[model samples]
Target: MKLETTHASADVASEVVFEAKGLKKEYDDGRVHALRGVNFRITQGEFVVILGPSGCGKTTLLQMLGALAEPSAGILHYRGKSLADLADPASYRAREIGIIFQAFHLLPTFTAVENVQMPMFETDRPAAERTERAVELLKLVALGHRLDHFPSKLSGGEKQRVAIARSLANGPTVLLADEPTGNLDSENSKKILELIIRLRREQNMTLVLVTHDLNIARMATRTIEMKDGLIVADQQVPQTAA
Candidate 1:
């Protein structure tokens, strides 16, 4: 199925996953305008990739979308409600968003399974159930065999897989990945992208990926190109036949 501009429209159904209108950001005492009235919408189960050159504010926009950073101006709605309306953004993030970073950001001291189970501490699930879920998620990322391996022991790809499993621990509806394959070799990068696409297909989750790689952007159903902190091109690529 193809995505449309109306996808970001406010009249969209309540099930719409994420929407941003007239978004703007500034820094350095208004010396830098990171975003200039940016706007976009993302729906549930859709994979949207944002592509940009350096200093285009891709990371800033992603941070805002993930609720890690607030927009200097504009409105962002999640599940049909404004983010500003949320009584607690931290709690919302814990429950609804999964953020993956390029660094993998795994605990050096914690084993793979422990890293995956970390989020469960904030949750009320029993320890046994948390362990089981972490194991299952690791297996989903094909890292069950390295469940006990520390970050230093696993290869870069394996570490990223572990991070992915950790991101999935909470079963978030939206997954925001920032340059997830940035540090990997070509083969490993392809593997990581395939894993993300497979997981999106299986879970029917909403995915917003920020990447510099054109090839990586092509994998997404829709590509939104940003420049100077504004969306210069938003295009839907033709899907390949089955």
Candidate 2:
């Protein structure tokens, strides 16, 4: 699909934040195909919900977008640059992409502040700067009071809040979330979704969220539905959907 996009940045000068051409991922010696050559383009400033049932390859697609895994076939691009060509994929991830996993992947031994500071270490900022940024981000996520608390000491909602703070540690432009509210109760899920929407607008970040919940998908400006590893639907959401 050719999604014509107007350039959005003065640096990369591209509106297309991500483009997947014939993207594929296979496992178990090609016996299982997680993704079957799906293609799509995400533009800047878009709130995109990737909706599908479990095992529909939504998470696999998100992983490729985050550079957390490689595609078994085809290519993925960020701002028109191939992900495979990145000199340091870790550096790219830390600087350009923010990721929220389904599991709140917080370090049990590290405090919330310390966990938030982990991504900034990839940057050249001084310790004091990293500390300041972490504090700022935690406060942004309403977790400032829990800065000194470890993952084991926090509630599920609190821990996920810490994870959200950690994801924004390095100020990435692209935010890839894989079912962030899956572990939370209804109230917490609402809170988390509100926080995420507010953050995306405040930061003007490109958000590609993966979820099966139609309630969540309704709030998005766009939704891409996947089935058995192929994109079945991609459409602009109606104003009333939100």
Best by lDDT: 2
lDDT of 1 at 85: 73
Candidate 1: count the clashes. 0
Instruction: Give me the displacement of residue 93 in model 2, in angstroms.
Output: 0.8
Q: State residue 64's C-alpha deviation in candidate 1, in Å.
A: 0.6
What value does the lDDT take at residue 64 in candidate 2? 89
Question: How far does residue 22 in candidate 2 sit from its true spot (Å)?
Answer: 1.0
* Stretch of 10 with least lDDT, candidate 2: 1-10
lDDT of 2 at 66: 85
Q: lDDT per residue, candidate 2, 88-183, as tens digits?
A: 999888888888877889888999999999988888889998898888888888888888998999988888888888888777778899999999
Q: Clashes in each model (backbone N, CA, C under 3 Å)? A: 0, 0
Error of 1 at 206 (Å): 0.7
User: Residue-wise lDDT of candidate 1 within 1-242, one digit each (tens)?
Assistant: 21112133334323678888999999988899999888888877778899999899999999988888788889989887888678888877776778889999999999999999987787888999989888888988889799999999999999999999888878776789999999999999999989988887666677899999999877787889999999999887666510
Scored by CA lDDT, what does every candidate get?
0.84, 0.86
Model 2, position 150, has a per-residue lDDT of: 88
Error of 1 at 157 (Å): 0.1
lDDT computed for candidate 2:
0.86
